[model samples]
Target chain A: MIILGVDPGLTRCGVGVIEAGAYRRLSFIHVDVVRSDPKSPQDRRLLTIYDGLAAKLDEFAPDVVSIERVFAQENRNTVLGTAQAAGMAMLAAAQRNIPVALHTPTESKMAITGNGKAEKIQMERMVARILNLNTLPKPADAADALAIAICHALRPAGAIQGGEREEHLTAAQRQWAKAAQKASRGRTQGRAM
Target chain B: MIILGVDPGLTRCGVGVIEAGAYRRLSFIHVDVVRSDPKSPQDRRLLTIYDGLAAKLDEFAPDVVSIERVFAQENRNTVLGTAQAAGMAMLAAAQRNIPVALHTPTESKMAITGNGKAEKIQMERMVARILNLNTLPKPADAADALAIAICHALRPAGAIQGGEREEHLTAAQRQWAKAAQKASRGRTQGRAM
Candidate 1:
């Protein structure tokens, strides 16, 4: 399954595309940041975002889109613009008949890293390892977008997201546990390189 | 000059159009409330707003658009959706190369009723009187939208919006005051009927 992730912001939005393969192996297809000029008027800025997202949707044709769900409580100054940018991303995905899923930042972090409170550097390293990249995804926002896509890809099949606790994993999900152990071991080996 | 005013909301976005003539005379061209089902996914709802605003921008081809400037500090629950809808409206206007102006609720209310804190009924009555409507504009959002357009129309030439207080009106804008007085008198007569 293909997943497109979006970390939305008015000034800079991040996008990443990946394909989840058998045994939950994830491969990176693309990662980049979409930017708008702060000097431009608000309308133009929003159009840039919408147009960029739409173009990517056409190019990637991902099966599903994952967006970082932002809370207004995060920052008073930027929440409105962030929400607007997120809205544009959502519209771009929906117009193409693609299903969109929103994951909180914490949820994405926990999926990418075992810790919900994983720091940025840790996240970049984990994302790099999972996608088997030679270098880390740069500019934070792009890395976060890729992480969100992975979060959606990691969502349990036919099970609700944000609800399943690790301890309560179903018998079939124990397979996921085994795979996660392998990924963790891979991370340990990757640190040496 | 034709002005389109949008009062943005997720469930219901209000749109109003007006023609501003010589001597600051105003006439209503259209008023509507675009709605999206709350039951629909968030992405679909945003798409509905974007499509609706785009259609209006094409149909009216307004010289300018005036959208209510929402603050994140207003209502935490709805402000995000409101900002997103406002972004859609702004994008529609910008895509058509029509300038977009944002008017705060206080500015719009002050323009319509001479009271920045005017109540909904007062704003509706004043908007009806200014536009020479037969009856009050139904739905507070639609009325607020018309009021925002009037606020934009009433904006002084080359004067910055949300600044330059009434006490500091230039000699030219004093003409707007006279026209405002005429509108106020019209409101009194409208009240009798």
Candidate 2:
């Protein structure tokens, strides 16, 4: 499966994709959406992000998209920008009908490293090691994007492709997919009813 | 005076400088830092950002460095990466003792266009028109960086430098500088104080 990991931002978005299997293929792309003109309305910033990301999605078509989940910060302004960037990524994935998985910082770190609270240096080292690259990825943004994709690759296959909806399923696969489907239904019904 | 505008990232930091007055000069330099090894640590990423940016600052010896401020978003991941990118810019400028000036989207737009809310196409057109370039700046990031420096040039002398000081008084001639400084104060103080 082809998985695209996104590091969304108002000014720049980092994207990396990895194909699952022993001989995996990887591609890294960074999209910069220069913020809208100050003379323009605030809403235009969103549009700029939208258009920029859409162009990127068009260029890199992937089966799955993984984005880092939002984390709390002290700055409201920073949080707002993060939200806008995340929203843009979600919109892109939804528009393309691509399944998306949100990976937390800790989850990505733990997957890359043995520890969840791994320092930036540690995570970079682990990412480089996992990818069998000669040097660490330059620009932490790119590394983080790659790391998110790595995290998704390590997830259960059913969690990603909707286990129940699979056209063909082994007996064991069906058991897991059925349970997952039931759980999803229970959560949805819990919310609806 | 020549002002170098840098968009610092680990992989690629867009560099552009513009000098005004009797002899006008405009050049766009792209610095690419790629680590072939995936297992490298995150500190290595920052180091690459530092080494690449420092070389440019030395080679160009810009009078001032104008940069884009890091704004937050809903995606904690993007915020972290952009913050790192902005931090790299700040460190590179501060290391050279090259006065740093930050321009917001609005101020940059206003300087390029009469309105703060001008569209990206409008700002790109204006950047090309004002600079008398035959074509639009390739890679919007480069254009945005140049636009920022152009904005700085149009502002009153010493506006950006003076505004860097927290206790400074605003100068009417540098309204954009004053406003940008005021907005950046909260984040700047965290680093300075």
Candidate 3:
């Protein structure tokens, strides 16, 4: 399965595409950052993000799209922009009938580095290692996008299995698990991205 | 000039169209609400909003689009959805090269009732009176939307002219003026919605 991952942002949106090979092997297809002029109108910037991602979807044609989910606790000034960018990405994916998965930042870190609280550098290093890349992905946003895709690529087979394991998790871990479950519920229920 | 005004929301988005005739006479063209099922996935809901608004823009072909400018202080749970919906409205307008204008709640209230703190019923009554509608617009959202369009229609010719009048304003009024000016700046500067 090919996955398109989006690190949604207003000024700079990161997009990464990866193909899952036999035995869970992954190969990179494309990675890039779509930048919008901060000087542009908010709606125009959003349109730039939307048009950029729509073009990428057309070019890459990934089977599924994964994006970071926005939470209220994020930086207030940028949260709305990020959410709008994510909304654009989801809209692009939905327009094409591609399934969308939302992964939280902690879930992405855990997927890449086996620790929900892994530092950015560690997460980047692990993404490089997992993808067998000699060099790290340029721009932290791009690496972050790749990490989101990897999380979806390595997601557990079923929520039932994940739920069964949740009983053993700590409170914080359980919270993350529940949030992830709520996000992933969209995959099955055809609910909001 | 024609204006399309949107009261952006996730569950129910209000849309109104009005024509600004010579001598500033206003006539209502259309008003209604676009709703999305809460049970639908986030992406699906956004698409429903985008598609609905896109269709309106196509049919109305308004000269400009006006929408409520989102503030960070709004209800936390619904703010992101509202922002995303507003972004969709802006995108629809931008796609058609329609000039987009944003008005705050205070601005809309003030424009309709000559008082920034006017109650909903007051704003609705003024909207009905301004449009010469015998019956009040059903659904408060639609009336709110008509107020936004009317605000745009009656807006001063330029910010510089409004700024000249700011010396006579109260502290709270000056603050709202500044916010409105900043938002209007984005329209000309091509800044984010």
Candidate 4:
């Protein structure tokens, strides 16, 4: 299965693509960072992030998209922009009917280094080792993106799918879907995992 | 001048439109709430909000779009969603090449009721009085949207314009533009107010 991972940010969003094969062997497909001028209008910066993710989604068409879930406890100066970028990534994936899975920083770190509080360099080293690469993923964000993708690939089945109905989802996901249906009563289009 | 104001939220996004006439008179144009189920997938909820705002932007073609500026200090559980909603509002207006203005909740309250820390009921009543309406605007969120629009109308001219060149902006805005231009060095499109 192919997975596209996004480390979302307005100025420098990181995207990584990887494939998981038989016996859990992984192969790297692509990695890159999208940049936007921070001093530009907030809307303009947002458009850059959105358009970048949309292009990546179209080009890769991965089986699943994994994104780092942003927390409000992050730096106050950057949390809003990060959340906006992440939102655009999710929207791009949904538009293509690709399933999405969100992994927190801790979860990704745990999956990659077996330590929730692992240092950045350690995590990068682990990523390099996992992919058998001689060099580390240059920018920190790109390495983080690959880590998130690996986390999703290693996680058990549970994710948000585009236009999915409750009956096809697991119990926990179904409960949430049922609550959504109950609130909308009749007009909601459809829910996800 | 026509202004569109958005009190952005995922579950109940409030949108309001108003016209500024001669002698500083303000006339109400429209007000409504767009809701998406919270239990639905984050992407689906965001799409609903984005589509709703896009429809309004196309229909009104407002001269300015005023959105509430969200802070990370907001309730931890809701800040991310609120920021995403506000980002979508900005995106919708930007897509139409309309100028976007951001106002804090304090600013909106001060404009409507002359008190930055006024209560919701007070602000709603002031909004009704300003619009010469006998009935209070239903739903607090809708009233807040109208208050934000009024705040933009009453403030001096200064805003984020769509695709504006650095030369056309004020000195304060120009500083930011120059910084962005310096960063991009060559390839950035145009910036805004």
Q: Positional deviation of B137 in candidate 4, in angstroms?
A: 1.0
lDDT for B166 (candidate 3): 65
- Minimum summed lDDT over a 10-residue window in model 1 chain B is located at B184-193
Against the true structure, candidate 1 has what lDDT?
A: 0.80
Ranking according to lDDT, highest score first = 3, 1, 4, 2
Q: Indicate which candidate wins on DockQ.
A: 3
lDDT of 4 by residue, A30-84 (tens): 8899888978888888888888888988888899999887766554467778888
Tens-place lDDT per residue, model 2, A25-124, is 3433332232434343223444565566667667778787887765444354545455446555665666567766776665676556646668998888
Error in Å for residue B172 of model 2: 11
Off by over 4 Å in 2: A1-193, B10-12, B22-41, B73-76, B157-193
What's the CA error at residue B72 for candidate 1, in Å? 1.4
lDDT of 2 by residue, B59-164 (tens): 8788888876555532333444444545555555665667777667777776667566789899989878877677887776667777877777765444445535
The TM-scores, one per candidate, come to 0.85, 0.44, 0.88, 0.80
Full candidate order by DockQ, most accurate first: 3, 1, 4, 2
Q: Give candidate 1 regions above 4 Å deviation.
A: A158-193, B161-193
Against the true structure, what is model 3's DockQ?
0.41
* Model 1 error, position A159 (Å): 4.9
Candidate number with the higher DockQ (2 or 3): 3
- Regarding TM-score, does 1 or 4 come out ahead? 1
